[model samples]
Target: MIDILLVPIVLVIILVMLHSYFGMEILKRGIIFTDLAIAQFAALGSSISLGYFHEEHFYLLTLSFALFSAFLIAFASTRKLHLEAFIGILYVLGASGIMMVLSHSAEGMEHFKSLLASDILFTPPMEVAKSAVIYAFIAIALYFIYPKLSGFLKELLFFSLLAITVTSSVSLAGVFVVFVLLIAPPFVALSLNFKKPLLGSFIFGWFFSISAITISYFYDLPTGYSVVFLGAFLTALVVLAASKKALEN
Candidate 1:
């Protein structure tokens, strides 16, 4: 059991570490659904690839669509038009586009479902390592280069990195997992008024993710869905507790 869980635990930790910092930025910017929209576009691109190739590697195709989404959202962020509304439109377009692409495929529905929630238990070690390297590179760039960017360039760089992150994440962990990881931990940390929200988010995300993975292993639950449930549940509890405390105060 220990050996079986080792890889998944490592993967979740890495994912949370990479994503929590970005989540703080997203939350601060009030673009809550941006990652979901980008991830959905990536999934749509992958669906098209699946329709043609019957496989899901389609990284370049997915990255292309994700970057397209980033471009639109980054531009919209500066506009008077409602950014959330624009993101919602993109999300819906990606969803409908996916359905249209998978309409006639033999396993269309199954493929669609898988795109929403892949079986992370079967992820290849090579893929895991590759994602880790990609995430590390992004982290390094953010640390060294992000501060120097300004205005349009800053928005572009942030969204572009987010797009790349979502492209890889959606392909491996699926849309639900990516969205949950990108939002839940940060939400909880912020609500609790943590001194360092990013670090707080990473710790809480790791705790819930590892617990969920262990529970899934024991009970045969879907790992991705398990993580989603625990993340949401924990975050909701934090929000509620915070609200109650505020009311008392």
Candidate 2:
């Protein structure tokens, strides 16, 4: 059981670091909603594909759908209308379509529940391996592209990373905890005035994630919710301390 949990926890930490980096980039660029929107779109696409595809094909279907969602968002960002508004509309439409598709299928509720909240504890070993491979691809892609990604390309990369991170995280931590992973570490790092922001964010993410998992293991609390609460609490304490230090200075 410890070994099983350890692998997923390590994967979650790597994902959290990638998520924090791109999330901060998105926040800086004022495209926060882009992540949520693309994630919903990917979820809808994956949920729909599951109706016709086997479990083995699920990751491929999800990756295709996620990439398509990224393309659509990137295209829309270049148009005259507000990207945020467009993303909102796309989210609603995609989400509604997914619900409609699921309504006609026998496994609808099961798939929907998985898409909505995820069940990391029940994740199969094969699926864990698959997720790790996907994370590897994402990490490598980001590493190579980081140098060339600038201007609109940087934003595009942000959208892509957000989509991948959100989808992967939603499969484990759910959307709420995904949001926590995206936001909390940066908050902690910023409040602490860390010199190396990326390193600081990564440290905070790992600390909060491990703490949350420990709390969930010892107590009966939901892992995802525990993570969010612990992250928020830590961020608040860091900010408060920072504020006090500033006042003293």
Candidate 3:
């Protein structure tokens, strides 16, 4: 049981590292909603799959759906018209669809509930392994492509990474807190501008992760919500301090 809990927490650390890295890039590009939208879409897709498939195949379905959604969103962003409105519409429709799917099936409701609020404490070792592998692939892809990622392509890759991170984290931490994993570290890195953005992001992510997990362990708070609140508070402090420093300068 201790092992099971540790696995997911470790995976969450890795996920947050990757999220912070790409999240900083996304923040630089001004397309934060892309993460939230893709996550919702992946949830919607997974719910639909659960209605038809059994538990064993659900992970594959989730990965496939998330990747597909990322591709679609990336493609849409390249168009002349602003894609924010379209992505917003998709988020609403996807969330609605998830609720509808949950309402219709009995067993599906249990799965949906789990999906809506992840049991990170009881997350399977297999799931953690899978997440680790996925995160590695994303990290490698980002490293190689990063030099070439400029202009629209850069924006697209950042959005794609955000989508992947949010969808995966939402599955573990719930969608509500995925926002924290997406936004907070970047804000911390931005405020500090500590010479190396990636290093700053990793430090901030570790700080937020450790603080949240400790609070959850001692206070019996919801881990996800605790992380989000702590991250938000820290981010707000950083922003305010940076603003004051800027004013003085």
Candidate 4:
């Protein structure tokens, strides 16, 4: 059982590291569902690849759609529009497009389920390793390159990097999993006013994700959805309780 779980454990650890940072940043930016919109667009691209092209050029299509979403968001960031509402519209647009594209395929529902969340218990170790390398590069960009930019270019780079992250993550985990991982940890940490929100986010993310994976294994639940449910559930409870305490103070 350890052998089976080892890879998933490592995967979640890496995911927590990369995703928590983005989650914190997204929370600060106040565009909460940006990752969701980008992820849905990425999934839309994959759906197109699967439906018509037999999944050919999967990564390219996924990245392209993700980048397109990033570009749109970046451009809109400069405007004085209702940013969250615009992002929500984009989210629905991508989602409906996905349904339209996959509506006729025999494996459409299964594909849709996987797009929402895949059983990461069966994920290939090599895939996790590849994503780690990609994430490492992204981390470098965040650390060194991101600080040096300004204005529109900075916004573009930020969302574009997010696009790249979500592009890979949506395929590796699923759309909802990506959204939760990007929101829950940081949301919980920020709600409680943690001094080091990123570290706090990491701890919370690991706790729930690992617990969910373990529970899923012991009970034969879907690992991906298990992670989603536990992570979201725990974070919601933490934030709500914390809010009530804050109100009392």
Candidate 5:
């Protein structure tokens, strides 16, 4: 059990640390669904690669589509339009596009389910290491380059980095897993007004993710969806309870 879970535990910890930062920033911008839209687009690219090309060019296509979505969202951010609504529309379009692409594939439904959430318990060690390297580079950029940018350039860089992150994460953990990791723990930390919200997010994310992994291992449940379910369910309960208390007080 220890050997089996060690890689996954490390992967989840890395995911939570990186995603919590973006999740906090996304919440601050009040564009909650931007990550979802970008993730959907990335999934669309993967679907295209699977359906038409037999999974060749998967990374290239996924990164390309994710970057495309990021560019559109960044542009919309500078416009006078309803940004959230626009992002919602982009999400739907990517979703519908994915369905259309995969409609003819024999493994269409299975592929779709995997896109939504994969069995991260069986994730490859090499893949985890690769993603970690990519994330490290992204973190360096965010620390140095991101702080110096302003205006539309800043928005583009931010979303582009997010797209890159989602592209890798979507392939590894699936879309809903990425979304939850990007939102849930951060949402809880922000709602509770934690001083070091990122640290709080890491704690919450690690708690739910590790707990879910343990439960899934013992119960023979799907690991990715287990994480998604526990993260979402627990975060929603916490936020709702907090909101109710705030309203009362």
Candidate 6:
């Protein structure tokens, strides 16, 4: 059991560390669904690879689609159109595109499910390493380049980095997992009105992710779905607690 879970737990921790920071940024910017839209597009790309291309260069395809969507959103963010509404449209369009691509494949439903909720328990070590490297590079860029940007360039850099992160994450943890990881933990921390919300979010994300992985392993449940369930549960609990605190104040 220890051997079986060690890799996945480490992988989840790595993911949490990388995503929680970005999640805080997303929450602060009020573009809550941006990651979801990018992830869905990445998943759509994956579905296309499975359905038509026999999984050839699947990651590249996914990254391409995600980056394309990211650039579109970045450009749109500067436009007069409502940003959130445009993001919603992107999300829906990506989702519908997935269905259209999968409509005729024999493995359509299964592939679709995998795209939404991947089987992280069976994730390869090499994939984990590659993700770590990509995340590390993004982290470096954020540290060095993000602070120097202004106006539209800053927004573009942020979304582009988010797209790269989501591209790798969607392939491993699926869209729902990626969304939960990006939103729930940061939400929990921010709802509490923490001064250092990113740190709090990192802790919250780690706790839930570890707990979910353990519970799923013991019960033979799906790891990705388990994380989603636990994340939602924790988020709800935190929101209720925050609400109660607000009422008290």
Candidate 1 residues 177-244, lDDT tens each? 88888899989988888998888899999999899999999999998889899988988887888875
- Model 4 lDDT tens row, 1-249: 998999988988999889999988888889999999999999999999999999999999999999999999999999999999999999999999999999999999999999999899988999999999999999999999999999999999999999999998999999988988889999999999999988999999999999999999999999999999999889878888888533563
List of clashing residue pairs for candidate 6: none
| Deviation of model 1 at 106, angstroms | 1.6
Clashes of each: 0, 0, 0, 0, 0, 0
Of the two candidates 2 and 4, the one with more favorable lDDT, higher being better, is 4
* Model 4 stretches with alpha carbons more than 4 Å out: 245-249
| RMSD after CA superposition, every candidate | 2.1, 4.1, 3.6, 1.7, 1.6, 2.1
Which ten-residue region of model 6 has the weakest summed lDDT? 240-249
Identify the superior model by TM-score, candidate 3 or candidate 5. Answer: 5
Indicate the worst ten consecutive residues by lDDT in candidate 5. 240-249
Local error of candidate 2 at residue 218 (angstroms): 2.5
Model 2 lowest lDDT segment of ten: 114-123
* Model 2 per-residue lDDT tens digits across residues 21-51: 8767666656666666666777776776776
lDDT by residue for model 6 over 1-249, one digit each (tens)? 887888888889989887998898888878899999999999888888998999897988899999989999999988988889999999999999999999999999998988888878888889999999999999999999999999889989999999999999988899999999989988988789889888888889999988999999889999999999999988998788787533563
* Per-residue accuracy of model 5 over 184-230 as CA lDDT, tens digit each: 99999988989999999999999999999999999999999999999
Superior by lDDT: candidate 3 or candidate 6: 6
Q: Write the per-residue lDDT of candidate 3 for residues 1-249, one digit (tens) a residue.
A: 355347656866776787777677667757677677777777876787777664456656766666677777777777876677777877787788888877877876666555555546556777778777878887887888867878667756756666676666777777656667777888778877779877887888778776776677677776666777788888888878887533563
TM-score for all predictions?
Answer: 0.95, 0.79, 0.82, 0.97, 0.98, 0.96
For residue 234, model 5's alpha carbon misses the true position, in angstroms, by 0.8
Q: Which candidate is the best by lDDT?
A: 5
Which segments of candidate 1 are over 4 A away from where they belong? 244-249
